[model samples]
Target: MPWKNQSGGPWGSGPKGPWGSGPQPAGPRPPDLEDLLRRGQDRLQQLMPGGHLSGFGIGLVALVIIVIWLFSGVFRVQSEELGIVLRFGKYVRDAQPGLNYHLPYPIETVLLPKALRVNTTSIGMTLVEDPARGNRTIMRDVPEESLMLTGDENIVDVDFTVLWRIKPNGAADYLFNIQNPEGTVKAVAESAMREVIGHSDIQPILTGARTATEQAVQQLMQKTLDHYGSGVLIQQVQMQKVNPPSQVIEAFNDVQNAKIDYERLQNEAQTYANRVVPDAKGRAAKIVQEAEGYKQQAVAEAKGQSARFLKVYDEYVKAKNVTRERIYLETMERILGHSQKLMVDGPAGQGVVPYLPLNELTPHRQTPATTGSARQSSGVTK
Candidate 1:
């Protein structure tokens, strides 16, 4: 009734409907299911030898399809990969690196995880793409991750990398136990590093304790991961940089230089002592030995003088007059031994005779001849 309207059957006097003249443009329409079914059946019959699809032909086609589906389960695992098989979304077993099979499709599936691949995670730094430099990636510092407190109540900046890999026998745990493996590794590494830094002094951390810190953090990370069943093997922990906070770095360097100078001065003083002490000891020993020699010589000479005096006293006591005359003669000989001399041979009351123009005459006399002549004359007079 709506189509048969008053104005020429609602189409404005056109026998062809809403579309205007020149051959109606085609519009969308639902597919004919019966036609499609008939065409498929005709194609199946044509493929058969007798131009009809028998029960046997249908069964044969299904068998071929089933065989192809069954063969689809076969897969190859690479040398570095481990295949994990799951049944109905539940873990079933692990497969080695070779040709392996599992139940096909919805019944079972296999996951290929790279068990031997090494992964690197960096803490305290991030890679960012630089568009100005032809899209190359550059490292950018993450201060929040890098800054840590030391045992000496100092803030230090530390950057490091962690090398890790999935355990060969624990690939299943690696895949299923941890949901964001890389993120978990980064968090654990940062936590471990902070713990180590917190227990260390700032000076050692910045200078000598880098390797120790790395080892400690790596061991701690491994332990924590194992406890969580993360199945991650820690290969190495590498420290990139450790330094005082930027604001205080210059002052820290100045302090280090001062310490180095102090040590240098100490070493120089020790060296001076090493060189000078032995020489002083040697001089002191020489002086002491000389003094000992001098003391011994003086004592021996005094003892000899005393013995001679006692012998003379004994002689004098035996013959007093003769001994006195001999002693006077000996005293005269000793007192006049090295002097120019003249002898007076007159009477006892006579005064001394004039002394030697002879001495002046022989001013260049040979001393041995003069002394011998004097000694012989004195002996004759006695």
Candidate 2:
């Protein structure tokens, strides 16, 4: 009735209807339910042999769909992956690599986690996209993560990387126990590194203890993750850099160089001592040996002289007069053997002359020149 009126339907008969404008142009109408039903029935009839859907045809169609749905449960697992099966959202069992099967969706499901793939997590640095540089990624240091306190109350900047992977036998725990595997690994790595650094000195950390720190951090992280059943296997921990804070780096380097110089000087002194001490000891030993030899020679000579004097005393005690007379004659012979002299038998009464020219009688007393000079001097004196 309103449509027949044509006065903007329910609104008043005027150019303005309802709120303001008059009636608008008719738009596209909604689809008719009866027409849609008739079309669907026609399509079904065309698909069926008797121009109508039968009970057997419906059953056969459902059977084919069910078969396809059942086959949809099949999945292929990669070689590096470990498949975990869940029933009714509960973990049921594990599946190995290759083709595997489980109940269809809403009943059972499979999760393929790469158990053998190595995952790397950096502790103190982040890669950020640089818009100014053509969207390239650049490493940005995080001071909060990199700076830590040492055992000696010193601060050190440390950057390290952790290599990890899902445990093969613990894939279920990896997925169920830990919500975010990589995040959990990163947090654990940072915590472990901080703990290790806290117990170490800054000097060794910046120098030769990098490998040791890495090993300690890895072991500690693995132990912690195991305690929580995180199902993470830590493969390796690598230290990217370890150094004193930038503010004190120059001073630290100077101190290290001084320490090196000190050690070098100590080594040189030790080497010199090693060389000189042996030579000094050898010279002292040689001097002592020479003194000992001289002492022995003196003692031997004194003993020989005393033994000879004792033998002579014993001979004197046995024959006093003869020994004395022989000693007197020997002393006189020794005293006058080289003298120029003549002996008288008696005082000017025997056949011996009182004075004799002993010097002239000796052939070896004077030469011809000496004799001529002597005669000339005698003549001159006469």
Candidate 3:
């Protein structure tokens, strides 16, 4: 609202202003600086009861204000915290954990951050575990972060968690070097995971190679953060879930089952072969041994007979007449031994008659003798 005087002119140019010289305004006028100061002094003297503003009164007021201003600079840093001090918006020094002091606000300040606390960055999924629910976890998937490509040009879903903490001696860098430490850690974690996954096949990621993958990601994240001077130490990498995309899970299962079946069949066949091959080889060796033995026996017998025949031939060559007579006698003796003989002697002009032994010709005895047997048929001669 615009102020006006009695003559209806504006207050700045009116004939009576607040000073009662411009236009003679009747209502309460705005107090001047000097009037307000005098009134404040009067009120202070009245409130003091028996005291007045002597020589030391103003000095005491200044001393109390100074004490409060100095005390305002005092602060305590907890055991787990690292205090970063800044003077006039410029970094001064790092304060140790304990009671510490600095210049009052606007001149120096302190930033206390928990340097020993372990922080976690979860990629792909966030898990909320409920203690009342028997420690069951509820997961919220972040598909944009989780989906990754594998080395074999396959899509896989990877859920992992990165455990990290600010370096104890590097807290200053952690606080001042990076604008957002948590965001940097998370971005590095996601990038490291992707790089590892991109170099690996889907089969190993989904199966027994998950541990190796986690370690690789952790190492890569540590290297990357170290390079960027992030002052974050990666403690561990934990893989929660590694699997094929949902759309291809059924197909992947079917392929895995087929591979298992094929391997089983190959193992069974190899087992059967392992059982039969040795036996067959053993039987073959036995047969060959028996044939060799028979061949040796036949050769030994043939050699013995040839040696005996050669000795007999040498004796026959030494005494031909005596040997011929002796052989004839032995032949006759062998011939007459197994047969019953009847002699019939005739005159010199008549031919010799052979005698037959009808009594010896029995059914049971009517058998042919082998050439080498000691039995023979006989004929009589003059």
TM-scores, in order shown?
Answer: 0.73, 0.68, 0.69
| Tens digits of per-residue lDDT for model 2, 2-108 | 12212343223221111222332211222333554455566667898878778776566556556755776787778888877656556788888888887765465
Residue-by-residue lDDT tens digits, candidate 1, 164-210: 99986887677667666788899999999999999999988877888
Top model number, TM-score: 1
What shift in Å separates residue 334 of candidate 2 from its native position after superposition? 9.0
Ranking, lDDT, top scorer first: 1, 2, 3
Question: Residue 65 CA error for candidate 1 (Å)?
Answer: 3.4
How well does candidate 1 score on lDDT at residue 353?
Answer: 52
Each prediction's whole-model lDDT (CA)? 0.77, 0.76, 0.73
Mark the 10 consecutive residues where model 3 has the least summed lDDT. Answer: 12-21
Give the alpha carbon lDDT tens digit for every residue of 249-344 in model 3.
899889989999999999999999999999999999999999999999999999999997788688789998887898789889999776655566
Candidate No. with top lDDT: 1
Better of 1 and 3 by lDDT: 1
Let me know the TM-score candidate 1 reaches against the reference structure: 0.73
Determine which window of 10 residues in candidate 2 has minimal summed lDDT.
Answer: 12-21
